[model samples]
Target: MVFLKTLAYITLVLPLVVYLILNKRNNNKPSRVIFYYLVYSIVHEILVYYLTNFTDNISDSNAIPLLYAIFTIIEFFFLGYYIYDSLKNKLFKKVLLLCSIIFLITALINLFFIISSGVNNQLIDTIPVSTSAILLIIFSILYLFEEIQAPKIGFIYSNPKFWIIVGIMIYFTGTFFFFLLFSDLSGKDQYNYWIINLICIILKNIFFTISFFLPLENENSNEFDSSFGINHYNTIK
Candidate 1:
């Protein structure tokens, strides 16, 4: 478990460093948002780790659920926006926006009303996490579909957005069932299954790092605009 934990930390930290380096060269909106997400994730992890280790009082540990709930809300919004900005399909974009709004409303309700009544807000608020995962899965599929329909621009794997979508698909798909079942799991079961989440997270970060290393392409170029029917770079800006 210790080794697994260490590996997970390295995976998370390495991606952040990669993003920072890449951003220094040329920081696009999507990459900047993802970099901020990684920084938030690292800080949250450190806070949770130290708080759990240093505190004897369980009530003080309520910080974990609170922090996680807040993070989930912010993460869902930023990631959903990133996907929305990347896609060109009008109908799909509307669908993404509608779903995101619904998810945001649901998450707000869970955070304000349901969370306080539960021993752990994170467990009780699984709906938001699960919903976010499902929406992301849908967006990932849509992104891939768009990619397939678009004219081939060099190697598809070389596209940074392709790797980002791939990472989202892998992470969200792996954790979809986990988050759905999280509230139902016994303490021991939750502890045991956490390794699965950690493994998925590591894989996601590895993909993210790879994406950062890929050569930056001009998102507003004529090829991309003709294929996607939108100037994604301008849209993002």
Candidate 2:
């Protein structure tokens, strides 16, 4: 668990370093959102680690759940926006946007319930995290299918969009079951299970960081971005 948390912090910070080195020269709407997401994640993870370890008062309170609930909403917004930008179909985008709205409203309701319940049970507002994972996973599969159908796009590994979505898949799949089973586990078990979550998040951050460093589209490359149809570089904004 200690190793995983260390890795998580390292991986989380690496992306920020890469972004600073690139200096937004490679920034696209998708990458920009990803960068900000990393920044937000670093802050949240630090706070969680501190509150969970240093403060005895938080162990039995709703503090952790409440903090995570709010972070889940913010995380979903960034990822949803990423998906919104990556997908090409107008109807899909509209549906995704609508789903995002509904999710926010539902999550806020959950937050309210959590705050008012005064329950000290291990139960959390896992609905938001689980729902976000399932929704993003489904949409990511849609995106991969979309890529498979495209005849002119280059190797999937070479596409920046591919890496971003893949990172989402990795993070969600890694922690999905953990969150699902969280309420059923003993507190000690939950602590150990968090190692799994952290490891996956580390990979997600690594892939996200790699997306920024990959060779950009040039006249000689076969890379075709679905969002732009062609190599429309800086116009993604």
Candidate 3:
């Protein structure tokens, strides 16, 4: 358990390190939404650990859940924006927007009405987490389909977005049921099974780091790809 926790922390930072190195080498896109998300993640984890263990003025019981409730919204926003930006299909874009607005409403209601109101007894609110997982999984798959049907690069996996989407796909798929079942699981079971989440986190971060190494040829809001060992896009006219 301790080792897995340590490993998870390491995995979370690895991508950030890779991103910074790539940037210095002029191997990264101008926009750094992924970098911002990585920083947000590390900060949230630290805050959770501190609030749960050290903070005394605040009620200990609600701290972590409250943090998660709020951070979960931002979490979805970043990943959703990434997918939305990567996609080009007009109908699909509209669907993504509508689903996002619906999710925002539902997640906000869950945060304010249930988690913060003290009307609910559960330590963690599963609704936001579960809903976000489902939406992200579906959208990730859609992005994958869009990429497959009209690929920009010679080899599909050469694209950085491919790695990013796969990371999101694998993480949400692996943890979807675990998070949905969180509220019902016994303390012992939760403790024993939490490693599954940790493993998925590690895998997601590993893939994210790989994506950073392969910079997108077009993070310029013009989605394109770079082949392996190449950093710039090649045009054949």
Candidate 4:
């Protein structure tokens, strides 16, 4: 278990290191947001690791769940914005924004009122996490469909965002049920099931590494013409 956990940590950190080194030459908003997300994930994991090891009281150690709640909200915003920026359909973008707002509001409510009142916030609050997974899975499917519907570009496999979304889809879809059961799992069950999450994490990071290493393209390049081709649209402009 320790070896698996260590491997997971290595996988998580490797992508961030690769991205930082490769992005020095050129950087874009989406990639920068992804880098920030990766950093936050590493920090969150480290904090949880230390807190779990040093703390004795469950209430005092509720930092894991609290951090997860907060991180889920922020993660959804970053990923939603990335997806919105990647797609050209105005309706899809609006839907993504609306869902993100609703998710954030729901998460805030969970954090403030729904969870245990005091500093502990012991409740894992899987509602927001599961919702995020489901919504992201849906959006990822839509992204693939959109890609397929549009005229062919360079091999879809070669597109960096394609791999990133594929990673998201696989991770979120695989973990949806796990998040639903996380708060209820026994210690033994958790230990057993955690490998699943670790595997997904490794896969997600691998995809991220692939994305970072792919050749950079101008955000506004007219390489493909489609009403839904987000690569051609310059959101910054």
lDDT of 4 by residue, 14-127 (tens): 888888788763287777877888898998888877777877885554567787888888888777777888887777778778878888888888877535655654346778
Cand. 1 Cα-lDDT:
0.80
Whole-model Cα lDDT per candidate? Answer: 0.80, 0.81, 0.81, 0.79
**TM-score of candidate 3 against the unseen true structure:** 0.86
1 against 4, candidate with superior lDDT: 1
Candidate 2 per-residue C-alpha lDDT over 1-237 given as tens digits, one digit per residue, 9 for 90 to 100: 777878888988997898889965556677788889889988888888898899987766887888888899999999888888878778777888888888889999988988887655654556788998888887788778776766554677887778888999998988899998888888899888888888898889888888888755542356455456644655676
Instruction: Report per-prediction Cα RMSD to one decimal.
Output: 6.2, 6.3, 6.0, 6.1
TM-score of each: 0.87, 0.86, 0.86, 0.86
What local lDDT does model 4 show for residue 140? 78
Measured by TM-score, how close is model 2 to the native structure?
0.86
lDDT of 3 by residue, 1-237 (tens): 999999999999998898888785425332277778889999999998887678874453556677788888998999999898888899889999999999999888877765556543465577889899999999998988887776353466777778888889898899888889998999888888889889999999998988888856543434344442245434442
Query: Candidates 1 and 2: which is better by TM-score?
Result: 1
The segments of candidate 3 whose C-alpha lies over 4 angstroms from its true place after superposition are 24-31, 57-60, 119-121, 151-153, 218-237
lDDT value, residue 157 of candidate 4: 76
